[model samples]
Target: MSRHLLLGVALLAALHSAYAGGKVLMLLQSEKNIDRFSSFTDALTAAGFTIEIKGYKDSSLKLREYGTWLYDDLVLFAPKAEGFGGSIDQQTILDFVDSGHNVLLGVNSDVSEAMRNLAAEFGVDLDDRGTKVYDHFHYAVKEDGKQDHTLIAATDLVDSPVMVGGPYKQPILFRGLAASVPSNSELATVVLSAPGTAYSHDPKKSMIEPPALMVGAAASLVTAVQARNNARMVVAGSVEMFSNDIFNSQVTVNGASTATANKDFCVTLTRWAFQDRGVLVASNLRHHLLGSEEQPWGYRVNDDVEFLVDVMEHEGGVAKPYKADDIQLEFIMLNPYVRVPLQHDGQGTFSLRFKVPDVYGVFKYFIDYSHRGYSYIKLTHQVPVRPFKHDEYERFLVCAYPYYASAASVMAAFFALGFFFLYHK
Candidate 1:
């Protein structure tokens, strides 16, 4: 089927498509406890998302219709399904994301290979089949004396406010397997990590050797990835964590009972994944002379120039100017000639003033901002730098007085020699 893919569009293009409550397509399993995630779906709806739920094997399921994408975001809640129905498949979902859409994937202990493949494509490696995360030290106490130690009360969240919204005051109940995220990956961020004493292994089997696969904080329970195109994806280990039961249940960590913070965290995560928060777009990139607004055709060596841009963060269908102190600009040719931090005006405008280097060539104004939990923004504007014209040079200079005197003396001597020759003849 033909797809109207939105590639190379401006950063605001995605936001504009989602400003009027973007459509979300959720694929779920019928046999599974679908009713459990009502709280999560309700939260997404409350946050201005038009959700359309479909069974994993629904024949009518289609991501694109009439050569246009039908949804702006997707939710994969059927982790055990081997493959999707109709025309939906792993590549279809990938293509959806490649076009700058969003996805929220939830996997369980019985996660299928297809789900693993999808997670792997986003740089998250799910543990082997039949294995689950075991946190004996921080396991939540069940009501009926069940000794299953897989229900973990994870508290090791990434220390990023933009990702998690804020510090989680209470523990999040996570009962699922563990995954690994690349430590050096700039696109992937570990949202939740297993406790230091946690390990992943087959609960039914005995320990033959120490668990080497995933252990401690290295085992990630939740990870978020923002692709280079600014498409967002959240890989969650436990689909049950979004259930209404877990959302309303209480979690005990170290014998202290506290209400689960899963609802708040899940809502925040959904909001981020669906582009309701932490989305940034830059506009009106302007550069001109220091004292004038008109941009010249080209810059001169050592010329003073001013640069300005507006950056806005969209949330709750409203756009507000982004405020930050670390946004920078790079004046570049083959290498950066000037790298300076822009000053914000309390609104969303960031401006900078600097003198052009004493070299003449092609230059570009580059802004590459990538903050945790926020959409990536890269803007570049190229302009030429011309050398001084002949008339532009100074007619007289104190440093060249000696050379001027020498040239004048030579001319006078030649004229005197001609006069002497004529008179002697």
Candidate 2:
């Protein structure tokens, strides 16, 4: 019946709705394969997302119509389309990412100039001549000594729980040929690579000069870009790598003669690409003195303060947050004055309590927490530390106070003796 109570109830409902809602949109070119699109859509949906697939050929489709807000996420599976069917062109897609939304670009051996241009925009150089990757030493071998270089098996994956599947039961090995450059961009992180034995070339023709790009030294298979704005993008050299057939296929690597399923690798790669595994989120951040209820505007020299942050996976389940030993903190000015490991409280909180240094100046509590499969967490809280106040100084030093009293008494004695001597004389 009260207006204030009604307002409070309305605010709670709005908060809940915002937290519980999210959508995924897929934009495809006319020639895009139905199977690949369907598989990706199904995976996202199974992950509890509401997905909508649209074709660029649709007459009503226009990137400008949506302006800066087309979709929360975009999937570009139509690499061969010379241009988008909608008003959305290459520039429009770039703008979408610039505005902070996720994008997935899947390029196969049949990479087009348009696809290469897009990859270049993201600082990736796909071999223009359509070179297939070949690894004689690491390729899948048959009964004969010759290697099956076409369907090469790669297991030299980046040892990142976030990039690869978490603690794979068996090694995730893939038998396919894809080309990528070495991990070079400061903004991008490489997830998969061709083994040291692998190299890219025109597999149809015989070698002329030593291959242009060497394996292990100059190629990547799968690379992920996490922009400064936290917009995520995955660039893969092969699209069929995520197909149901490849996902379910099994292979053997090295001396393991028996062939096993390669489904694990496919599943792991998909999870990493679709934002499944490595999703670090900031839970709680706080700063306060050791024994006070109040959080001060600044700290005092040698004051003990506790810095805490709770990190957890974004997906809901029974997963635990960062363990007691899994977090770290930095007391930084320009560089870190102190880089200390945080102890967890056994609950969800990872915290560190340390005394402020006697030095006084502007300093920041910084935590750059990036786990392998999670989103990166960066936090900085600035607070200045002042020299101790006069009243706050230690009281009545035994040695110094005695010295002060003796000096005062000596002065009084000299004055009294002078007065007496003058009067007596």
Give per-residue CA lDDT, model 2, range 1-425, as digits (tens): 79999999997577444333245666565535566546545766675556667775665655445355745666676656566665777887788778766677877667778888888788677765457777766665444555566556655566776566545444434433354554445767667777777777776677877666656636777777877666677787766566565554444457655442345554455555545555565665888999875778999989888887777654322235655365679998777878998887766688788999888899998888665556677888899989989999878788698888999999999999999999996
RMSD of each: 5.0, 4.3
Candidate 2 ranges beyond 4 A from true positions:
1-22, 27-32, 36-40, 54-65, 140-148, 166-184, 204-206, 250-263, 316-320, 324-326, 332-337, 359-362, 399-406, 416-420
Cα error of candidate 2 at position 263, Å: 4.4
- Maximum-lDDT candidate: 1
Per residue, candidate 1 scores C-alpha lDDT tens digits across 76-195 of 989899998888999999999999999999999999999999999988999987888887788887555565588898889888776777587788899887899877888999899999
> Candidates' lDDT values, in order?
0.88, 0.66
Residue 352's lDDT in candidate 1? 96
- Candidate 1 displacement at residue 393 in angstroms: 0.8
